[model samples]
Target: MRATPDNGLKIRAQLEREGINVPSLSERTPSANSKSDRKKVIMGAVIFVLENAADALKFVPIPNPDAIPNLLLKWLKVYDTVGGNDDGLKELGNDIRKAYATVLQPLELSEQIPPEVVRLIGGFHSDLEEQINEIELLKSQHLAKRTILAADITKRISGVRTCINNALNSVSTQATILTLLREIEASSQLTLERLPRAAAEHTYVKSKSACRPSTRVKIQKSLLNHLKEAKNRFVWLRGSPEIGKTAISRSIASTLEKEGTLAASFFWDKSRTGVGLDSLEWFPSTLARQLAIFNGDFKASLVKRLRRPDSELILNLLPEEQMKTLVIEPMNRLRGIFSASTQRFGIILDGLDECGDPDALKSLMNLVLLLDGLPSAFVILTWIRLHQTRLLTQSG
Candidate 1:
């Protein structure tokens, strides 16, 4: 009831004027241009309505002054889906609070009202203050829940992929493309950045929306809790192709990232040929690079370990040695530093089925599972390879 057809037309017209055409009404989240001006106008209308109502109802008996500002935001949000006018709205809230204080300015209340009425107002104020604090806590929890819920709903509706091969649209290997790929295949001391670039140039799964939160909600929750138990040191998710294994893994990584627990991510694939499969050989070194960036001692130890005369040479160190020295030793020190239950470390391996080399995978699996004896560390393996199940059980 707050927004009219004319208001909708005005918003659509402004979007068209700015060449910000949203395809459907369902896609209500605003584009960048429409986010500000369009929301500003709607908020302005809401403020105007609140002002008019305040003036007319001034003489009528009212519940409380607090309701007035809350009403303003409630009515404003009825139209603006995205918080485009967040800063302006915050300023307005402050202004309304100041105006309310001015009117209630601790003046000669005894002269105008009975002592009982004054005491009642004071009690109401205290109750309102308590309610405000409670609302703040609830608001935060509710927002997080709603965010996860909305993203899950949107992805389910649209069938958005958890990950996609963007190799076709990747940055051009324009000059000597053949040479570049061959170099990658031959290279042993590659950095973490090239790993992602080489591994099929896939979508980075930047945000939580890269996951379907609802479908995986139960599993994700179970996994986190399971990590606390002894049996969850190695958690494996097996699923058929296109069955959302990658999506769930991405979601798990996203969750761990938020919790400051994600140590590293190495997503594999068959699409990028040399680069993707090449990742298998240097996976430990890549993870070491990632962890070193975050943990200083790990960096120092890693540098020392890799600084030997052999490092600058052909880089022919065995995979297990790389895992034990480059990864496990540093991670051991890290575990000592962050021994609290709240502090956790996690590694994610996705698309394990796509690894062309079985021996390389066996090495990686053995390396990953070495964390079993360590506290507050977990390894997540996702993908389907029925034949490899026996190998995995044997490794565990």
Candidate 2:
């Protein structure tokens, strides 16, 4: 076994054996805050160790000096006696290289090494370089996968939301309100915005003039209760022509509008002017116009048809399918759009008795039932009670 030296000499010998070209231990350690003095001592010791070892061993240091530096680091880590000293190790490495170069002639260590050594060192460098490239590629691929997955998940969630909203909109009248309430649960943003102000306004009008507050409250309460449960009931208000039937229907329509409700009202009359139900073709056109007003995209397309020089011709030329497409589809679409736009809307018909065509009344009712799929509508008929038998006798 080699004799161990004092701390200074032991460090020098270890550096030489481990191929660590640095100064002795004392020179490597700094007196508190004396970094320059510490650096000089460590550097001087490394130079001496490398030169002495080279002369004694009869071998030139390798051209690739990093091998010695790496070996020194491994030795320090493995040796429990070595303490924390990264700077010292680095200084040692630098000094080793410098000393070998300085005593070039004295050491007789200028011969180039064999191909096997060069290949061994070059192989390690190539492996490290390849590993770095692989790591960079893996990082890029992981980021790309994460971004794509996030986008796909977001799109699916949005699609579900849209489907839910569309279904809620298609619900007619009070069903519209109820469905919205369900979807939103505790949030009032959607429900409040959609509730029809017209419905509330009509209620206000009916209640404002009553002399007794209790009576007004009772009537308002009754109306709300009726409205809440009247979704599937067929309603008929039979009275004289000038009685409150039309007024009530108007009130209902106004109420539904205010609540942002979806509703359609048809008025039948004795007059055969183009305005009455006699001009059936205009019915779908009028309904489509209403739908277009509520839905912006349909407005421009519908307007194009309305403004055509052959507009009347086009309207007449509309096939039953086309008529259904324009009028019936819009009325059906109103179930959703009206509900979305307002809370409740339904069909309100007044003056059915005045139409003098009982068949028209029955036909209109059938159409309402067929198109709306629910009886949430309000139909007010003004007719002499005495004439009810004639109106009711029709096969329509």
Candidate 3:
């Protein structure tokens, strides 16, 4: 290329071609070939496009036609129109495309429009966040319910653990729980029982087994015979309070209880501070526990009855019923099982006058004697009432 002055001021570029057919300063036909040169420039651009872009269409199948850039396809079509007639233009087209892409990249926008326009992407994002918030709220509510249920389950587990620990301790503690279970079994034989009176609290009970054998000789002999003889099955004594009656009875009971021949006994004391003598309610049950403990064979029957599903209801039975159910019946059962050889028994019930109603005690006793259909079981009565005396006289 060379620069030349035109009309002394304009600068013009002139081709300096060697061995190429083009007009120059020395050539007189420059204007004559200018139209043909324009055709050559257009044809060169077509060949360059075909060389760079043609193979991209052939080697890579467009998996989604819609994914192709429309501008790229339009440009490819223009290149094919101009260069399709000449295969020599293919390489040049590919080289031009490399340069074309380098220049085009900086002009492209950041993103395409389809997801924003066709898919409602903004709504989808909002819905996702809303769903996440709802799930978090639900989790918080369920956590509270789970905590309450967990606490309840833990409480139940703790109760079971305590019960199991108590059982394990029983093995090392002399089977105290089993003894208590036996006591509970015996307790069922009684109904609304007045607490038992301690023997030491009784005035006539001087801790001796009998009234200084020298003091109550005749009384001792008679009471012993009554107890020893299982034939009579009933012995009624008539006496007054503080007249050596209770002394004899307690002496006899204390001695017999030790010998294991005493079935059951109730020493009445109105001053005893309970319903023990009130209608003799506690009489039967007190005797029952003693009898059940005395005879192992009888425990099975007593425990079986006491352990009934509704065994607590039995505690509400009348005193006479309690005596019949707990004492007389069990004694009779022993006699039945052991036959006539069943051991004779005695119950010392002294100080009847101290009862809330001595007549009630008398009536309940009379009921026992009247209903006396069992082996010999003697009762010693000591009271300070004339009415009871007449009642006893008639009943005895």
Candidate achieving the largest lDDT: 1
TM-score of model 3 vs. true structure: 0.44
Q: After superposition, how far is residue 17 of candidate 2 from its true place, in Å?
A: 99
Per-prediction tally of clashes: 0, 25, 7
* lDDT for predicted candidate 1 compared with the true structure: 0.50
Q: Write the per-residue lDDT of candidate 2 for residues 84-161, one digit (tens) a residue.
A: 243534433443333233322222453664444344434443443443343334334655654543444333323322
1 or 2, greater by lDDT = 1
Q: By the lDDT metric, which is better: model 1 or model 3? A: 1
Each prediction's whole-model lDDT (CA): 0.50, 0.41, 0.46
Residue-level error in angstroms, candidate 3, position 127: 86
TM-score of each: 0.45, 0.33, 0.44
Which residue runs of candidate 2 sit more than 4 Å off their true CA positions?
1-225, 228-230, 240-242, 271-274, 277-281, 295-314, 317-323, 331-342, 373-396
Ranking by lDDT: 1, 3, 2
Error of 3 at 394 (Å): 6.0
**Model 1 — which ten-residue stretch has the worst lDDT?**
160-169
Reference-based lDDT, residue 200, model 2: 17
